[model samples]
Each structure stands twice: as structure tokens, then as C-alpha cells.
Target: MTALPDLVLFAKYPVPGYAKTRLVPALGAAGAADLHRRLAERTVGILLQAGAPVEVRFAGAEEAAFRQWLGDGVRLIAQVEGGLTERLIDAARDHPHIFFGADTPDLDVGVVASARAELQNHDIVIGPAEDGGYYLIGMRQARPELLTDMPWSTDAVLRETLRRCDALGLGVALLPTLADCDRPEDLARWPQLEAPGRCA
Candidate 1:
């Protein structure tokens, strides 16, 4: 029997000027950071609701600060030093890990439940994002080829990732498509505040 994948949530420290910088033009440094913090909290709540262990591998702040920000019941760890891709490869070292991002807080518990089950049968499970990236990804082993030298934060992210998976003949399971709050204008696309929406 395969072990349940570890639930690893990736997030930032939400420090002004560093977190959510892309939205700074509209929300200011502080405001964008605040939004970033709130988004993470929302995702935390969703994980709690799903009855899944909350382990956050984060950047920008210490575990103590994250404890205060995210509240209790979450295990926080510092992300390995380096760029996103590097950190991803390191995280992938642990087999059977389901990686979730804080940006997609609107995720419903059902999606998480499904991802867990799919990981048992597939080499990877992807929760596609409207922006062409993925909100969630689960993998059974470290496949550095899928993590390195890829166009991250681009509309081709999902497409390119799938292409690589195909080239490697990896079994992939896809979940529902969702949106991520990346830009100021896209804030309107945020579903009504509800614990019921799919975590995008």
C-alpha cells in the first residue's frame, strides 16, 4: 500500500516590497503584502477543513513569524535557499508529496481529497490554473527534468509541463481548472468570499 502523500503548502513571508510584488502597482507594497497574507490564511483554513495536516515550506520569514501569522495547527519550515525551481527540485526529493500554493485559497476540500486518491495511482496529479500554471501538483518521485529550465509564471506553464510529462511517459491525472489572484484587475474574478469555492 502506498503511503499518503505529505501535504506541503508553499508560501511567502508577505513582507512589504517582496511579497506579491506583481500587484504592487495597484495595491501598494503594504497592501499587496497584506493581500498575500490573507490569501495564505484562507488556504490554511481550507486545509484544516479537509482534515489534512498543514505543513508550510515558506520563504521570507522565520517559522515563529509564520506561526503568529498562520495561527496554530500548522507546521512551518524554511524553504531551501535558492530560486523557485531549485526549491521545487529539493522539495520533490521527498516522494509522494502534494504541493499546494497559498495563492489558491479558494480551493474546496473535495479537490484535496481527490488529489490524494489520484496520487496513489498516477505518477503526478495536477490541479490546473486558469493562468496556465497549476494551483496544485502531486508527484510520486523526484523528476528534476520537470522542474528545471521551464517557463514558470507564464501562460505556457501548464502546457509545457504536460508536454514534458508526455515526453517522459509519466502518468498524469488532472483536476478541475481554477484561477489564481495574480493581478489587480483579476481580483474581480475572485469568487465570492466563501469556504466553498475550489482553491484556485
Candidate 2:
């Protein structure tokens, strides 16, 4: 069997007051953390069910806790100290990788498969998020600089990333846009997850 490309899920340890801060005003610290945990767990479950080889690259928690939370049979890597861009660059180096955030519950197996397929022919593949960031990014080869010095949490992220790709002469493929759970307004977009106790 051909070796599968790496699937990396970038997440923070779901700690109250640290995880999903934007949603705290609405969900409270503990509630927001619970939601974060649910989303990350759900994302991992979806990929595992699809039999996609995955690695959890995380910060703010230890491996033992993550293992207990996420269960066995998954590789866990501690994120190095840095901003999101720096960590992503380190993870994507030296391998073909498909990277995604844990907040995007709408990201299904099909989307991930599509990204892997596209990476076979394209240098980069991206799934645009409704909020102007991307939900997924895949690269056949390490191109860390492509992620550097850009707007991190703004609507222009997708556009800026594409612009960077162009400047680097990287061929790109874009997948369907999806919504991620972030701000309180975004909760309206996911009715199933909006109800109290639903995410738990």
C-alpha cells in the first residue's frame, strides 16, 4: 500500500480561559472550552472513521491528557512555541501535509479526501472558510514561507494566502467554502451545535 500523506490537526488544549476565547462572552469559559473539546474530538473522529492517518499537533496541554481526551491510536505532537504561522511552518516541513483547524465541524471526510487528491497534482490546496480564513490547507512539499507575514485572523487571510502562493509560483486548488465556529454570530450558522448541552 502507498504511504498516506500526513493529516495534521492544529489545536489548542481545551482549557477554560484559554481555548475558544472569542466565544467566551456567549458560552462562558467552561462552556467555550467544552465546545472546543467537542469540535476537536468530532474532527478527529471524522478523520479516523474515514481511516485517514492523522496527527494531533497541539499546544497548552500534555500528551497524556490528550491521549485520555482523544483516545489511543493517534500520534500526538507538541506544538513548538510561536504564533500560529510559525507552528504551522514547522509542522508542514519535510512532508506532504494536509493541515486544518479544529473549529470547523463542517469539514467532513469527503473534503479531506478531496484535498489529498488535489495535492497529488497541485502544489497547494485550500478550503476557504466563510469568515475569510481557510478551514484547510494542503501542501505536497514544505513551503513554510508561504504562510509567513500575513493577516492571521481576518477575512483577508484567504486572499493573502492565495496571493502568497502566486508569488511563490505554487499551483493551487480551492475547495468549497465552509463555516467555522468562532464568534457568537457564527453559532447561528450551526444550529445543531448551538443548543445548550448539545456540544457536550
Candidate 3:
């Protein structure tokens, strides 16, 4: 007699010099910003095709710009405040959601399908990225402790999150490893050819 929860996709406004900081040296701020826009659009495109009731959670100062960029079919919510942990905790409190960065172009439909399937049984689901962080994370239930006091934007993030899951006795499912377009070197690892592969 309980209604199933909704899925929310978290992202940020693609502001130049602010988004994708690691790739800026190789891509320049403008180029990196352009890439961010493309990445977000592609992610939303795929999620839209998945045919689920979904909303986009934009985290940053420019909520208006993000809303304009994302446009239609997405209900926009400003992250308001929180580090990654706080924002995610807030999101999970409202929905059984999955959050993914805009950087992973290779997150195919099958992988997303697998995540939704796994969510049926698991408390949390993680899609590990080739870099130290994860591309996607989903939770059927909110466990704020799993996200607190952990390093963000490091290779240790996924490992530490898993550790917290263990500490909290939460069941987690793993999705296939995908490449996150963080550093300049990650461009080669991307499966699609939407643009020229820029390297270090």
C-alpha cells in the first residue's frame, strides 16, 4: 500500500571556469564549459528516453541558467545548500533517486536499466567510474551516515562510500565501470565520438 518513490538526477550549471575544473588546463575554460553543456544535455536525453518520472536537481549559484539550459520535461530544484553528501542526503530523503555527473558519456541505456532493476532489491547502487569517483549512485532508502564525513572528488570516494555502506549494514549493488571525463587523459576512454579526443 505504499507508493514507489521517484528518481532525481543531480547536476550543476555549466558555468565556465567553475565546472569540470580538472579538465580546464587542457580544454581551456570556455571549451570545458561547452563540454559540460553537452554532457548535461546528453545525460538528460538518455534519462528522458528511459521513460521514467524524473526530475533534474541543479546545484550551484545560477539556478536560472541551469533551468534554461535543461528546459522542459524536467522539474528543477536548486540544491540550496550542502556538500555532495548533504545534497544527496536531502535528495534521497525525498525520492529513491540516482545521481550522476554530466561527465560520463558512455553510460548506456543498458547500464541505467540494470541500475533500476538492482534498485528493486538493494538499498544502494553504485556505478563506479574509471577515475576514483563513481558515475552514478542510487538509493532506495536514505542513509545519511553513508555520505557524511567522506572525501569528495577523489579516487577514494567510491571505496569510502562502500565502506560506510558496510559500516551501516546497507546492501549495495554495483553497476559496470564507466569512464568519467574528469582529467584530460579520460577523453580517450570515452566510447562515443561526439567530439575529437583531446589528450594530455
Candidate 4:
């Protein structure tokens, strides 16, 4: 039997003062959190269109809270305590799975399809974010070293990850560059959140 494709979504629980903190200076506390929740919802809705099983591994909230937010029907998994890399490692069990965070509001099914298709030939696939980070990562198997300690939230993230992939001899495929909502300037990427001073 063919193995099913898994899509792991790493998301924050949208708690005020915890989620989308960088945007809080502009969107305020509750607004930023609310916006994150909406963005995550949009991402989940889009992923569901791919007709593949999506496991939502979340941080900053409990299972019941996630169910209440994303719905009881969604497959919700709590993220293990640690930094981003460790949490990512925890969710790397599903073979040929593509994992992404909830910050990219415009994520669509085509990118997902491309990632899955690219994984057929490449050992890993990564979608670069315009901000120098990555929007998604697709892997054929768990490769913890590929996700080890490194500079995160910087333009060097994508570059350093590629370097590590080379060091590990993992063939990687690159996807189209996308944007994620993490700061006030990044809000411009999404139309609804682009109005000046709206969040301030």
C-alpha cells in the first residue's frame, strides 16, 4: 500500500503576550493574538483543500484549547517543550511530510503539491520566505541535524539551513519565495492587515 502524505502544521496557541509578539507593538496585544488565530485558521482551511492528513502540532496551549479553536475534528498534537528546532524534530516522524508554521497567511495548496512532488526526487524541499527565513520544509524522513541549533528569525536562516543540508549530503529542492507575518512591516504582505496605524 502507498504511504499517506502527512502535513504537519506547527502553530502557536494565539495567546495574548505570547503569540505574534513582534506585531504587538503595532497591533496591540489582543489584536495581534486575534490576528494570529485568524491567520492560522486560514492556513488550516487552505491545507484541508489538499486532501491530505494534516497534523497540527501546537505550542502555548492545551489539546482542549486547540480543539475549541481549530475545531474538535482537527488532528491536534501538543508540541514538546523546547526551542523551535526541538519542536520541529518532535514532529518529524511522518515520512515525506511537509511542515510549516501559522505565520504565512497566503500559503496555498499548489506550494504543498510542489513540495510533495519535489520530495519524490529530492531528500528535502524548502520554501524560502522573503524575510530570509523559510515558510515550509518537506522531508522524506526525520533529519534532526538539519534542524539543529542555528540562527532563527534572521535572513541567514535559509542560507544556514542550506549549508547544513549540504554538510549532511541531503539533496534539497527550493520552492518559490513567500512572505510570513511576523512584524509590523510584514503586515503589508496581507491586504486586510496593511492599513497604516491600524494595528497601532
lDDT accuracy of residue 7 in candidate 3? 53
Following a full C-alpha superposition, what root-mean-square deviation does model 3 have from the true structure? 3.3
Q: Point out the higher-scoring one by lDDT: 3 or 4.
A: 4
Candidate 1 segments exceeding 4 Å error: 191-200
Predicted candidate 4 versus true structure: per-residue lDDT over 1-200, tens digit per residue: 44556888988888899998999998898888888888888788778878778889988877888888888546888889888888888888757888888887667889888887888889999999988889999888898887888787789999999999998899999999988888898776576864433322
Superior by TM-score: candidate 1 or candidate 4: 4
Per-residue lDDT of 1-200 in model 1, one digit per residue for the tens?
76767778889998999998987887788877877877887788777776656688989887888888888888877899888798887777566888888776458889999998998999999999988999998898878888899899889989999999999999999999988888877766664422223334
Ranking of all predicted structures according to TM-score, beginning with the best and ending with the worst: 2, 4, 1, 3
Candidate 2: stretches off by over 4 Å = 196-200
RMSD values for the candidates in order, in angstroms, are 3.3, 1.6, 3.3, 3.0
Cα lDDT tens digits for candidate 2, 65-155: 9998888867999998888888988888566788888998788888988888888888899999988999989888788777888789999
Give me the candidate number with maximum TM-score.
Answer: 2
What TM-score fits each model? 0.89, 0.94, 0.86, 0.91
Clash pairs of candidate 1?
104-200, 106-198, 106-199, 107-198, 107-199, 108-199
Candidate 1 global lDDT: 0.82
TM-score, prediction 2: 0.94
Q: For model 3, what is the error of residue 115's alpha carbon versus the real structure, in angstroms, after optimal superposition?
A: 0.5
Name the weakest run of 10 consecutive residues (lDDT summed) in model 3.
Answer: 191-200
Once fitted onto the true fold, the runs of candidate 3 whose alpha carbons sit more than 4 angstroms away are 1-5, 60-63, 191-200
10 residues in a row with least lDDT, candidate 4: 191-200
lDDT of each: 0.82, 0.86, 0.75, 0.83
